[model samples]
Target: MAVLETPGAAGEPEIEVQIRGLMLDPVTNMPIVVLKEVGSDVVLPIWVGVFEANAIALELEKTETPRPMTHDLLRNLAKGLNATVRKVVVSDLRADTFFASIWMEQGGETVVIDARPSDAIALALRWDCPIYVSSKVMRHTRQNNAETAANVGADDLKRWLENLNEDDTGQYKM
Candidate 1:
């Protein structure tokens, strides 16, 4: 089970979210991993590189590769070392870059490893663990969306991101 710390402020709870889908950004043509808060309308989109996106897509579709992929190898290594992946957290956003932490347990000891949001998410899927996002990051995303909306002279970006449905995430190609 995933354990999250209580927020210090009201309306600032650590949100448990799921991978809504993965799609390509129309403008930048970058891969975006869309995460939606459980039982809520809040959404967070993190743009990622092509290779990382490919790793996520492969797992998302449950495609089997003849050889173990990097994420697969990591999962195997953890198991071999008697480590269990507890959870993954999208812990922070800084200068438009998002950060994540991979929480693991080994021999009654807890370990936290810093990672990119994309990598952490990929590992989370492999481990079948819960994913979380800090309320502060969600607030920052909303603020950034507003700023982007204003600069774009329309709320298209925000609207488009918030309104993405499962069908909108077509097969992500390399």
Candidate 2:
């Protein structure tokens, strides 16, 4: 999976990938973040927990929930502290496990808070913050690319595309 970062992520992280879609697993009842390369046609799938997935999905759909969720609370807390989530860094990938940090700015100082990639991403979505994964993490993800492709066969992709019998609109509609 590519680290998230928009123009605001950090010093302008290259926008190599864009979130293509979010899929819910039947068994886990959780959501998967789908990313597609900017030009080339490649997709990365990252599974996420239900609570965090809901946070990201809500942002994509531009839907406001009845109340602020945990992520929202974190965002407010950041603001109250005069801090801003500058960017989220996806820093590590080992044994298929990923790690991350939330970079915040306050009092002209930058702070990096350790976090799980999934949680950082969820919070990033809620705070309208940019996401950044290190180049090293991207390289590691590349190492697993082949295995990822083999697991998701062409037949599987066809089946998935067929299931999405709707327009590829801008809205995430997750």
Candidate 3:
């Protein structure tokens, strides 16, 4: 559990993060969560899965599925227990793995459960909750961002942009 104070230690305003949009890795075809701060241009890329991204996109696009998804099942259980999701915290990053926790209140008892940042994010969108990343995870994301971006080809970028405009919503195969 990392505490991210609003007034950052260096006197810089803490970067406020929010879901930017959905994109697929041009190389691996894996789904990615686009995190960005409102009014700021810097974006953090976190790779997720096709199913998970679809779940998130449904919520973002405000489309309801005929049947409940896995994350939706979890949310339904939480609601049934009289629980409320507070936030999802991305607590650590090591060797390219990012860890997260879902903070929930059930019957007045607050519980934090370990989760993958990707899964945690999918649920966060459904619950309309905030997402936090420890400074370490943020730094790790930055390093991977550079490596992934540098290797992507010109044709991949052109195709990705077109897909975004068309709202095709399929994962881009690398």
Candidate 4:
């Protein structure tokens, strides 16, 4: 299990989560990666770019391309260097953006690389490593959503996200 210690909330444990589904945002028609906390109903939806969404969806569906995708190349590179991906962490949420870190171990040293959450997640799937989200990120997401809801009357959006089901996600089209 991977855990991130929050600054103010010392000892705060990172929540392990898995990719619940990938779907299009109802309002914006953008891609969303839904991550559900392990053994819990808590979920987080992260909006991602179209290309990044395609990358994640391709991995999720196990679709094969003739040539290696960027993420596949990354996996090959890491393995070629004798580095093992320990885990990926959704580390923070700031200014409506999410941040992630890829933890890799080579020999006796561990390296943490800053990455976009979408890229980190795609790599996580390729590496078959654990995925975690900082508790602080979860808190911030809720607070931000609440504030946005109050300001823009987007409560329905929040409700939709919270109530997403398998049928609601459907299949992601490239």
The digit string of per-residue lDDT tens for model 4 on 135-172 reads: 88878877877887787785865777768777888755
lDDT (tens digit, per residue) of candidate 1 on 17-121: 888889988889899999988887668999998989999999988999999999999999999999999888888887878988898999999898999999999
What is each predicted model's overall lDDT from 0 to 1?
Answer: 0.84, 0.65, 0.68, 0.84
- Expressed as tens digits, the lDDT of each residue in 90-124 for candidate 2 is 66667877777788989999898988766787787
Q: Sorted by TM-score, highest first, which candidate order results?
A: 1, 4, 3, 2
**Candidate 4's C-alpha lDDT?**
0.84
Worst 10 residues of 4 by lDDT: 1-10
Given candidate 4, what's the lDDT at residue 152? 73
Number of clashes in every candidate structure?
Answer: 0, 1, 1, 0
Model 1 CA deviation exceeding 4 Å by range: 1-13, 171-174
By TM-score, is 1 or 4 better? 1
Query: Which 10 successive residues of model 1 have the least lDDT summed?
Result: 1-10
- Model 2 misplaced regions, further than 4 Å: 1-16, 25-30, 37-42, 150-174
- Per-prediction TM-score: 0.89, 0.72, 0.73, 0.87
Between candidates 3 and 4, name the one with more favorable TM-score. 4
How well does candidate 2 score on lDDT at residue 20? 66
